[model samples]
Target: MQEPSDVLVLAERHGDVLTLTLNRPDQFNALSEAMLDALQAQFDGCRDDTGLRVVVLAARGRAFCAGHDLKQMRTHEGDADYYRDLFARCGRLMQSIVGCPVPVIARVHGTATAAGCQLVASCDLAVAADTARFAVSGINVGLFCSTPAVALTRNVSLKNAFEMLVTGQFISAAQAVERGLVNHAVPDDQLDQAVSGLVDAIVAKSPLAVRIGKAMVYRQLGMPLPQAYEYAAGVMAENMLTDDVSEGIDAFMQKRPAQFRGK
Candidate 1:
């Protein structure tokens, strides 16, 4: 495993698992322009590297992320273009995580508010500490969490999303899991182990199959039912032609574990 860098901190790797730690603990790992850029670069690197199979997004400190840095925003509030560009960049950063070829898992250990909660919802899977809490509280500060609502609405029911947006009240990790925002809720001490277990399960699969399957799921989810099925069938057909698929099937027939080269 590589050491943590000045930008995005990294740790732990066994084969294809890459754990990315958000490093701004002082501000609860708040999303800043520099942090966004660092995250984008890391996601891009992971996309181009076939050796990487999974990404674990974990943060340092007591909060996963306090969302966008209000101080940073205040510094450019007078400049409309600056504010627009900043938010646009943030959006792109979120999209990068969503569109990465490898599956991404969010390991939340603390409060995840506003855009932070959106980050959890955007991930392919998320496991949160039982002590963790989530909220979309931009409304309390006069700014509506419109951007966060985009992800929150898709992950949960309309009523549930609206309640969080309107009330700006915090919900426990269990509530997050029950509302479909988090995949599981475990004890704080077990968060790392739980994340590792889930990543191991992902990495055990053929990388090419997992990547193609993940991409197809996101693409098809936005289309009509029939069209979605058609798209999925196309993806499956293409995936079946890969060398990994052949090896996988042959290994199954031969009663052995498949050795995939991600071809």
Candidate 2:
């Protein structure tokens, strides 16, 4: 199904990378129901496209994202089932970013708080501007950032994740890098160039290798060391069977650049 033309999430296809820009700057790009649906739709669209190699999740305006639309949630508040369903929907949206075959990189320009922070944590990688800030700050409003914690803890240490969840304190982009929430942070002026450079470098690689590696890394993180290696060895064996692997080896032998079909 096609989303409306006036989607809260604006998608731009530039060569092999799809940049999904979160609109609603006036609202700090809050993940309203419409925004969540739009984001999920774009992810779904990318899943079957063999030509697509990466996704750059970005947002416009002052804040990257401010979490769920408070006004919308409060409208349906006091209804247990409504809250449950809403959270479940949000979880699915976040999962799609991880589940997508292609790598997803967060192009964080400003504050990403609560569920917004979860969005950053959920991406395969993130690059933030120096002006950006992050927090799992639902606690400030008397609600613990339980769902955000799911993704946050996966990307960071237990103690670090817990402190952010409980303190409602916003951390600088540099601190985000140190805590492992983001890969790195650069000057605000360099943010766009940094994201573009990273994406360009990634899409130039064998898409098949990138796809398999990104997925395996996330999966193995949950397993015991021995089991993880076992699982990884199997993945490598399968990857080696691909035509891209053979092409890469041949190119290396020939002293030429690889032209991968991602086969």
Candidate 3:
């Protein structure tokens, strides 16, 4: 497909993989109105397209994302409507990432702070380079990252999340992984390889299974133990009826690799 304006660069394919690159490297890929709009549009398109399987969120900068552009926020100071709308748009963007039918992966290479860390947590999976660092430092600037707290709280423990928010200290990639913030921490030079490995693992599965499985996992996460089991049972029953499952079962019985059409 044709690229969109270079402001929100999206490289997509039919085989269920899409890569979105935040293009504002000069400001450490900070979120801009144009970038947010482009991301919203791209994700909206992905929602409609059944062929899409996964999304890899990356950036073309030394830093993955520094968070909201303070300059932009300053420009809209005293305009309550503008601030409200801007944050609302950003929240929707993050929600889209979470609610996406396909799994979303955040590839973090450098500093991810405040809302940037929120973006990483919002994704289904995250792979960070050894050089990467994360912080929810909004409190240091007198603004609490109330919005980012939503995703952060869900991903890490209450104590861990509170520590990051309250202290605003930068945590290493290894520390992040241990705290359940990142799925994998790799050498900076091998960041690409590590991400590719993750993508390969994801794409190797039946697309429909992966998509539905991801959704079900999130759906049941907040449920009571018994209710979660009930929900999972229903999903499992439905999943067993799909053609991909049938093929997978047959392939296993026959001791051969299965070729899934993502049906």
Quote each prediction's TM-score.
Answer: 0.93, 0.96, 0.95
Residue 171 miss distance in model 3 (angstroms): 0.4
Query: Residue 58 lDDT in model 3?
Result: 92
Query: lDDT for every model?
Result: 0.89, 0.93, 0.90
Q: Candidate 2: where is the Cα deviation over 4 Å?
A: 1-5
Query: Candidate 1: where are CA atoms >4 Å away?
Result: 1-8, 11-14
- Model 2, 1-263: lDDT tens digits are 65634568888998888989998899999998888898999998988998999899999889999998998999986999988988899999999999999989999987999999999999998999998999999999999999999999999999999999999999999999999999989999999899989998998899999989988998998899999999999999999999999999999999999999989
TM-score of 3: 0.95
Candidate 3 per-residue lDDT over residues 118-210, each given as its tens digit: 999999999999889999999999988888999999999999999999989999999999999999999989988999899888888899999
- Collision count for each candidate, in order: 0, 0, 1
Poorest lDDT segment (10 consecutive residues) of candidate 2:
1-10
The CA-based lDDT of model 3 is what?
0.90
Quote the positional error of residue 149 for candidate 3 in Å: 0.6
